[model samples]
Target: MRKANSYLDLVLNPFNLFRTKRILNINPTVIPQRKEPESINLYVYDYDAENIHEERLKNVKDCFTYKHSNRVTWINIDGLRRTDVEVICNHYGIHPLVQEDILSIGQRPKVDEIEGVMFCLLNMLYFNEKESAVEVEQISIVLGEQFVLSFQEDASRDVFNPLRDKIQFRQNKIRQSGTDYLFYTLIDLIVDSYFVVMERLSDKIETLEEDIVRNPNKRTLARINQLRKEMIVLKRNIAPVRDMVNGILRSESNLLEERTGKYFKDIYDHIVQANDLAENYRDMMMNLHDLYLSNVNLKMNEVMKVMAIVTCLLAPATVIGGLFGMNFDVIPYAHHRWGFYIACSLMVLIPLVMLYIFRRRGWF
Candidate 1:
């Protein structure tokens, strides 16, 4: 039967040529996780010009008092799973769509203005040297008049510790300013972290450039491809961040004060610089790939040239041996006393003559 033949083909086809014949569902409600397992940690800190209060709570509900306090409150929820994002969303009046975006770890860098909150989504990128790959984590920030809430996918690591130190030491204007300025400081810190990632990438590119020149091999090619992929991931995350900062500048929301506009613009400029660096690195990666290919081809051509010279040198001897190997009774040197010596001499002489000609032509 035709159906039996079809089933047999499906079972016997080693290449799985018909694997794609199955219909694909265009709509699916799967929540994709891009990283390994994570644990949730909540940090709540409230501060003013002369005083500071910090607390690390195991539950999000425990921070309700600080969230509603008169002072500037910074509630950072690191890791997405343990605490209910919906409860935090309800506490802050965050939109349903924004809550979904927060839950979805793979959301791109963006900015959204809801009823009374300013929402931002961005990626924190770092180089994992042990794995030789770039790791990305999403950071979500919700800005309000009295509170600033941040969400991240990983609780084990972050780039905000310096900002925290600055705030605790009362070393900067962060304590003297309002929540909007605090928001600005946080954004500035995140943008500054991009430079660190870019620096690592630059170092990688430089090292790879040297490796390509010194000893290009399969491992070198693999590293080049890996770097290329990491660069792409950086560019993908950073390009939208630039646009998001620009969007914040153009937003008419009162949450961002007019005075903070300049700060956002400064962040914008930094993102642009980072983007340009990523682009330059991409171009360098492409050039390295091309150089690796050309090097391989040149080496192959050298090997082929040597082989061709060897074959040419042996051709004369091969012809002479074949001619004398025949069983003809009347060959040219068949009866000469020194026929064997003369034959050997010609064989040696012919190759020497060929070698001289090849040398003159600079074949080697």
Candidate 2:
């Protein structure tokens, strides 16, 4: 066997201990979707001016009995299942495209007018305190001659309890109005919810502003980036909703009653306000990001100024030592008995005089 001849060859050999080899797991594991079906909840609220009937239906077919009822019906499906949405939408004459939009996730807010129904889909936003983040759920509403069908992606919570109480405790205006008012009322509740979320976000921004002004650090920068992302998402989701509401107001569908036009107009104004607020918040985030950078740089410049002053004040001492320590036969102050003491005095006195000059001139 041949051996390495010198230290260079030995160090460069393949068998040396200095080299390292790594085997990476580039093939990530795939997580499969569950075959079991998630549960779906169906609720029916049928009401008129004199009386109201509310029930939670166990079977999907039971919901159809209200389809032909003369009273105004509100069928709220709390969870999305493709088969369930297709069946109920088919019964209500809702088109297949509308059904797909109802089941699809992350769809943009839009309005659609079909043969017998006027449909709109939008996002419902919620602030999660524990996660310090914004959460979103998709909601689709179908307005027909006798019924208003609402589909929600989440079943845990919604912002419709007030409407429920109003219905249960004899809110005469909604009870006396037609299905179009119920449709309008449902969309109105969604728009009103934006104000609540905006309030919470505003409070957060105010607090973050104080934090940025008082003391800025890495955590402050992280929070700034996070809030900037949230504002972008908030703005993106809200901007489309204004157009969707405007489309509804201009819709030619016969399902929209002429009397409800005023109510939809009010909602359009509110959406515009919400969009404006989102834009304002996005601008504030940009300003805060710039402020954070400026503060960090200002502090860094302070530290560098101090270091430069110290280096300048010590310059005389360094020069004197270098001159006397040179290995020359005729160097200044090299052979005198008192040369060391005299050089030390010069070193100390020169720095003191230079410091006075710097103070007078404000260089430091």
Candidate 3:
């Protein structure tokens, strides 16, 4: 029972590391014929608008009628928080390891070839105003010869919306295309979003660069450091996925069809662009550090100049005060009242003369 509860938590608990709080599950089966042995079973389950466990089971059963070779069925589950995900995974012959991977949120982008299926886990990042940070989520894809399975951290909103729309419209090549094409389309959406996120990061770096150059406040430095850390995290998550996507593009698997390879190529291109942008941002961050140091040095020089002028102006006054402070009765200022006035005038006049000389000489 304890182990079972742990498993339950894995499926039902919302993982926050990636900033996502929702999940969507898609189950597609391919069938070749509707009659006879029904060689393929096609089920496109749109698990939207409903969240009940019984409803989930009923929906899965509805698609269980026939498995035929001529047809491919797709099932899409929109909410990640539902317990039905675990239930459905158990109902299918899906490996517990795959289910484990799905339940574990915040995993980096990666690819795993398990048994005969290719499991691809990807990260999608979005800037969240509420959180004031980039929110990341895991998108898991299972590729097989007959069908493909996909899972999203949140079904409520995501890059996969376009793929959902394509499925709904039934007008595009998606409906007529193979499951591999559908997979490629989904990948294309993710890669495109990566570009969008890269642009946001680049803009941030640019802003920081400007701030550091013009006004390098402590607060600005803090923000730049924070952005640098975020970029490092982003790089760690994205780099491996770039390599994995490249591998998929070059693989001979029919899982990515010949026509669909172009879509993967597009994703690869975006990954390359994103990688370049990330490196550029890192370099800019280093430059900002140097700029901050330079600003500090320039400010110190300005402060020293003001101090030097104040000291120079006070030199003559100090000398006159010392002469009057002497205990010698023979001092001129100590003897006559008019002598004190004369001494004060000399003290004032001497600083003015010195100041003029310094100004003329450009010593200041």
Which candidate would rank higher by lDDT, 2 or 3?
2
Question: TM-score for each prediction?
Answer: 0.85, 0.84, 0.75
Q: What residue pairs clash in candidate 2, if any at all?
A: none
Judging by lDDT, tell me the better candidate of 1 and 3: 1
lDDT score for candidate 3 against the true structure: 0.65
Per-residue C-alpha lDDT of model 2 across residues 254-301, encoded as one tens digit per residue: 877788899999999999999999999999989998988998898889
Give the range of the ten consecutive residues with the poorest summed lDDT in model 3: 46-55
Q: Which numbered prediction scores highest in TM-score against the true structure?
A: 1
Residue pairs in candidate 1 whose N, alpha carbon or C atoms collide under 3 angstroms: none
For model 2, the stretches where C-alpha displacement exceeds 4 angstroms are 1-37, 330-342
In model 1, the runs with Cα more than 4 Å from the true position are 1-29, 32-39
lDDT of 2: 0.82
Question: Mind giving the per-residue lDDT tens digits that candidate 3 earns over 1-364?
Answer: 9889766754564232222222212212322121222121213633212211112333544544322434444455444433555655655556777777776655657777666667778877787654345667677777765556676655456786666555655456766677677677777787778777777777777787787778778767666666666676667667877888988877777466687878788788888888887787778778878888898788888799878887888888898888789888687658776987888888889889989998999877
Q: Is candidate 1 or candidate 3 better by TM-score?
A: 1
Rank the candidate models, highest lDDT first. Answer: 1, 2, 3
